[model samples]
Target: MHYKEAKHILSASNGMNLYRGCTHGCIYCDSRSTCYQFDHPFEDVEVKVNAPELLEDALCRKRNRCMIGTGSMCDPYLPIEKTELLTRRCLKMINRYDFGVSLLTKSDLVLRDLDLLQSINARSKAVVCTTLTTLGEELSRIVEPNVATTRRRAEMLKTVHEAGVHTGVWLCPILPFLNDTEENLRGLLDYCFDAGVEMIMNFGMGVTLRDGDRQYFYRKLDEHFPGMKERYIRAFGDSYQCASPNSAELMKIFQAECRAHGVRYEPDDCFAWLSEYEDKQVAAQISLF
Candidate 1:
C-alpha cells in the first residue's frame, strides 16, 4: 500500500473511495477494467491519507444531510485498514457530524466497527451492504479467493441486522455457466431472507465483460473452469452485457421470492433506501405521545 494526498474526498454525489485499488482478489471486479485507468497495479492499494479530514470538511459545508457512501470503487476494509484506520476515521467523522452512511463490502471485517455503525443508526441511518455471489463456499473461494466466503458474510449480515442496523445484499454478477443457476439463486436468496435483509440488489443473472476485466476473468476461468473461457468467447463474442440464457426464468423466480419475503428487489428502491437521510430530532418528536 502507498499513500496519496487527495485534493477532495467526496464525489459530486457524496460518494468517496478512501482507497483506489483492492486486494480482495475477486476475479470479476469491474474496477480493474481499463476504463477506470488505474496507474498502479490492481493489488497495489492507493490510500487517500487525508480522506477523514476532507470528508469532515465536505460534510460541514453540506446544507442538508444525506448518506455519505463508500466502497463503490474499492473496499474500505482491506487488510491494510486493520492498522491504518482511514475508513474508521471517516466513519467517526460521519457520526460526529450526524450524517448517515451506507457502505458495500465483501469483508466481515465490518464487524469491527459495529460500535460506530450502531451509534450512527441510532442517530440518522447506517446501512451495510454485503455481496452474496453464491451459496457454495468452495466455488466462492475459487472466484473470491482472498475475501470472506458467502456463509461468513451471511453471518455478518445476521449480526448487523440483529444490532438494528438495516442491511442489504448485492446478489450480483452471477457468472454465466458458473453461478447462473436456479439453485444458486434460491440458496442466496434464502440467506438474505434468513438474515432479514431489507433489500436484495441484482442486476441480472450474468456478468459484464470489459477489456481489462474480461481478460482477467477469462484467465481465471481458464485456470479453474477449463474450456469455459472459450465457451464465453463463442457465446458472447464482444457484447458488454453477457446475459445468461437462464436470465428470464431466474429473474421470474427472483421476483417471486423477493415479493413473498417482502424484500426490496428493485435497484432504484434499494439505492434510495441507502441514500435517504433521516433527521433524528424530527423522528424523536414524531414518536412522542
Candidate 2:
C-alpha cells in the first residue's frame, strides 16, 4: 500500500473511494476493466491519505446534509484499513456532520465500526451493503478468495440489522457456467431474507467482462476450472454482457422471494433509498406524545 494526497474526497453525488485497487481478489471485479486505467498493479492499493480531512471539509461546506457513500471503486475495509483506519475516520466525520452514510463491501471487517454506524443511525441513516453471489463455501473461496465467505457476510448483515442499522445486499456478477444455477440463486436469497435485509440489489443474473477484467477472469478460470476458459470463449466470443442461460429462471425466483419478503429489489428504487437521508432523532422527538 502507498499513500497519495487526494485533492478531494466526495464526488458530485457524495460518493468517495478512500482507496484505489483492491486485495480481495474477486476474479470478476468490474473495477479491473481497462476503462478505469490503473497505473499500478491491481494488488498495489493506493491509499488516499487525506480522505478524512477532505471529507470533513466537504461536509462542513455543504449547505444541506446528504448521505456520504463509499466503496464504489474500492472496498473501504480492505486489509490495509485494519491499521490505516481511513474509513473509520471518514465515518467519524460523517457522524460529526450529522450526515447519513451508505457503504458497500464484501469484508466482515466492517463489524469493527459498528459503534460508529449505530451512532450515525441514531441521528441519521447508516446502511451497510454487501455482495452475496453464492452460498457454497468452496465456490466462494475460488471466486472471492481473499474476502469474507458468503456465510460470514450473512452473519455480519444480521449483526448490523440487530444493531438497528439498515442492511442491504448486492446479488450480482453471477458468473456463467459457474454459480449460475437456480439453486445458487435461491440459497443466496434465503441468506438475505434470513438476515432481514432492507433491499437486495441485482442488475441481472450475469457478469460483465471487459478487456482488463475479462483476461484476468479467464486466466483464473483456466487455473481452477480446467476447460472453462475454452467454454466461455466459445459461448461469449468477446461479448461484454455474458448473461447466464439460467437468467430467466433465476429472475423469476428472485422476484417472487423479494416480493414475498417485502424487500426492495429494483435497482433504481434501492439507489434512491440509499441516497435519501433521514433524521431519526427528529422522528424520535416527534413520537414523544
Candidate 2, residue 273: CA error in Å?
0.8
lDDT of 1 at 100: 94
Predicted model with the maximum lDDT: 2
Candidate 2 least-lDDT 10 residues: 280-289
Quantify how close model 1 is to the true structure by its C-alpha RMSD in Å.
0.9
- Badly placed stretches (over 4 Å) of model 1 are 286-289
- In candidate 2, clashing pairs total 0
lDDT (CA) for every model shown? Answer: 0.92, 0.94
Q: Estimate, for each residue in 90-178, the C-alpha lDDT of model 2 and write its tens digit.
A: 99999998999999999999999999999999899999999998789999999999999899999999999999999999999898999
Angstrom error at residue 83, model 1 = 0.6
Give the Cα error of residue 76 in candidate 2, in Å: 0.6
Q: Which lDDT tens digits does candidate 1 get at residues 39-153?
A: 9999999999999999999999999998999988899889999999998999999999999999899999999999999999999999999999977899999999999889999
Q: What TM-score, computed on C-alpha atoms, does each candidate reach?
A: 0.98, 0.98
In Å, residue 2's CA in model 1 sits off its true spot by: 0.7
